[model samples]
Target chain A: MTADALPPRTVRSAPDRLLAVLAAFDHAHPALCLTDISRRAGLTLTTTHRLVGALTEWGALERDADGLYHVGLRLWEIAALAPRGLALRQVALPYLEDLYEATHENVQLAVRDGGEVVYVEWLSGRSAVGVHIRVGARWPLHATGVGLALLAHSGQPFQEAYCAGPLTAFTPYTIADPARLRRELAEVRRSGVAVSSRQITEDTLSVAAPVHGRDGGVTAAVSIVVPHATAQAAVLVPAVRLAARGISRALGWRPEAR
Target chain B: MTADALPPRTVRSAPDRLLAVLAAFDHAHPALCLTDISRRAGLTLTTTHRLVGALTEWGALERDADGLYHVGLRLWEIAALAPRGLALRQVALPYLEDLYEATHENVQLAVRDGGEVVYVEWLSGRSAVGVHIRVGARWPLHATGVGLALLAHSGQPFQEAYCAGPLTAFTPYTIADPARLRRELAEVRRSGVAVSSRQITEDTLSVAAPVHGRDGGVTAAVSIVVPHATAQAAVLVPAVRLAARGISRALGWRPEAR
Candidate 1:
């Protein structure tokens, strides 16, 4: 096919087209060439070239010696201002570190993003059991302990809407059924913790608790992952809860507010 | 003072206008209203509105309940791919944590950006001296231990340019004289460490070492900040150097390669 043979399609807005170029780079594809971006963004080569040039000039994208483009430090600096991401993580890191120190397990902090939980901070101990969680990773609200803690505390309408869904199960123990999920959530609310055993992985278990903000609303969740075979959920619950409460207080969540 | 009283300036490209909206937010001004964004971005209200709408839809800028816009999680997720930001911090954190444990002081990992050192990670100990450094904060090249380590190893052209003149001094101990800065850089290179004594603050001292990449080039620097009154630079040098070497090895740098 010749370049001039095809006719032009409807044009996308400048912002949409430019954002598409950035969206083309994700965890699985953190680096891409001009052609790859053009193809992935579904934009013509000329458009992609112009947009990439603009983004590169503005320091949103950096082109390496290999001619592959990666996200730039300038963008990272700006993204550090994200309240729900680095900003929140910065506030919660010390408590998370304490949790790791207390348990020597994989400690994580996450927040609800619609019906999913987005991990904002993850600290993995050297000998901790693998749970496949990383910062910026997301999972369904019913699949992980942090997810459950956040889901249980999310306001009634959002919780109900999420519970009504076709819950995707990762393991046999995942809370796929609506009634069972409701029961679990209620238990989490009552006990101030969520324990998910072999839900995401058969060999791993998680204990999580909700972190509240100044307004007395659950703003995030903190969790620790351990080996399911040797897991002591009861032992981990207090440490997890303590970390969550420490973070909550750090966020200005006073006991009287609750 | 009336509508349409001032004629419009020359038009900016759509991508530039959209980028301006994102650039409007920073550490000092992390949140903004539509009017604030419009004024700061130097775009007309209607243009800012449209660009912001596009960004909001694309999850670049999130509008909170108070009608203030903040950097969104989506941007943070994308920025996580930056090689010098979270990606590098993720690799260096365990070693940095070990340094914190060993010294019971503030441990930091920083990368040179232009002539400044941008801290990529900071683990603050409970009793650590307060040096006013945070993740994503930048400091002049001659004013910090990490900065000195990075600058000393940055090669001839950059070091010469940085040491030439106009070194901003944070304290009386800061290296402001060009000849003295050159001598310090030479000593840093020879000693494989940089001890910045109360350069940034009167009561804080930092000991730092350069971290090398697989290709034998210095990529970052790791440091420990302690109270000058109790700081034993001789005791700290080995710990900081060990942490930096640990991170360098983790990053695939080998002594044989160097």
Candidate 2:
């Protein structure tokens, strides 16, 4: 159900209130005070206090010495089991490291979350080119190599919906037109790799390939970012593709299965 | 409150029941079906169905095609904000990568949770020595080198309580005696490093050092594992300590602040 479908604040259910307490936290607002939490969760002060107390006692949230609430280690421990999150990252890290070693650039792993790409892992050398994305950073499907790789393999319905319009452009090179986006996806599928040049930033270029799972479906994408002035897509394409294949193999993908 | 102080299951609160549904999933039981969740959560079938429905709707748990529930990306996104978890690891990754480059061994970053050390990050080279610990693996405070480093700097009350005995042993080299444990901790404090030789496994040895935060508190530990037979603790000690210091500095630790 959409956010609009939720009952009024006064008539919200117990589970909704409890979930809302967790929903109050996000990438931009990691830590919050009691009043901040109450206001964000849309709950009364007393109810927010009681719910926060229960969550803290259950080790879902931690209260620091400064009396601010942050996500706790126990929740991280539980979240570590997410198959598409850390579990997938663990299997892909070695391959990502190899890609970093080969290119000495910024290597990344990302998965599609709706119309956006969420980075799960990133490896960069000390002297690597500057890339502004962090581990949990998100970008639109048309503006990143990893995003393009994931969107390319996401099937017709999702690709159609995402390319329908409103494709946010990050730079002059970003693909904003629906027909051009469809052509790019077809090229990505045909060439087994995607090269997004100066799409997210004026000086950055990315080359990416899709990673398959045991079920022979594309589950994630691997990419390497370098300076646009020093871009060598042809040389980097094989390395990125090899790393993606290695990670897919580690995840139990078989060439014969394809 | 302790487990014994909680009210009977029959009269449990709604929040507690909902949390119980989540608590049912752990490392050993990462995926479960509806029936399994019902039994493991100690809730009636109807309650289990309702709670699971709510959780799945909120994207806290994902139901796979096989009808098994696994932790979802949304929960992982929230958990990524844990200060002692991914947040700490992100700040420390470049230093950890430098350590890996210098030694080409298995490198790890961990933090203490009560009397145990929980690994937050690990980097291993292709030819690195075999270490069985994963990202979320836990070990007793007196067993591994990171554990020892954390336990030594965990303050006097915690040290005393932990050294009071019943320390479990993994191999013959594990610290099991209180008096010897106390001596080792003292040496760790004096040397600014900890050496755990064949403590967790007969073939592996670890060298670790404490990472201090801005408040001059030991917030985490960095370690390297190598083959026990060829381990040169002296060479590894400086590298591990330097990495720990670099991570501490990145975390805003200043030498003059001490």
* The candidate that achieves the highest DockQ relative to the unseen native structure: 1
Candidate 1: tens digits of C-alpha lDDT, residues A67-144: 999998889989999999999988898788777777778999999888899999998755677668788999998999
Off by over 4 Å in 2: A1-8, B1-8
lDDT against the true structure, per candidate, is 0.88, 0.90
Candidate 1's C-alpha lDDT?
A: 0.88
What TM-score against the true fold does each predicted structure earn? Answer: 0.95, 0.95
DockQ of 1: 0.74
- Report the number of the highest-lDDT candidate: 2
lDDT of 2 by residue, A146-208 (tens): 999999999889889889988888888899999999999999999999999999999999999
Candidate 1: clashing residue pairs, number: 0
Q: Tens-digit lDDT track for model 2 on B32-62?
A: 9987787877788798899998899888899
Looking at candidate 2 chain A, the ten consecutive residues that score lowest on lDDT are A1-10
DockQ of each: 0.74, 0.70
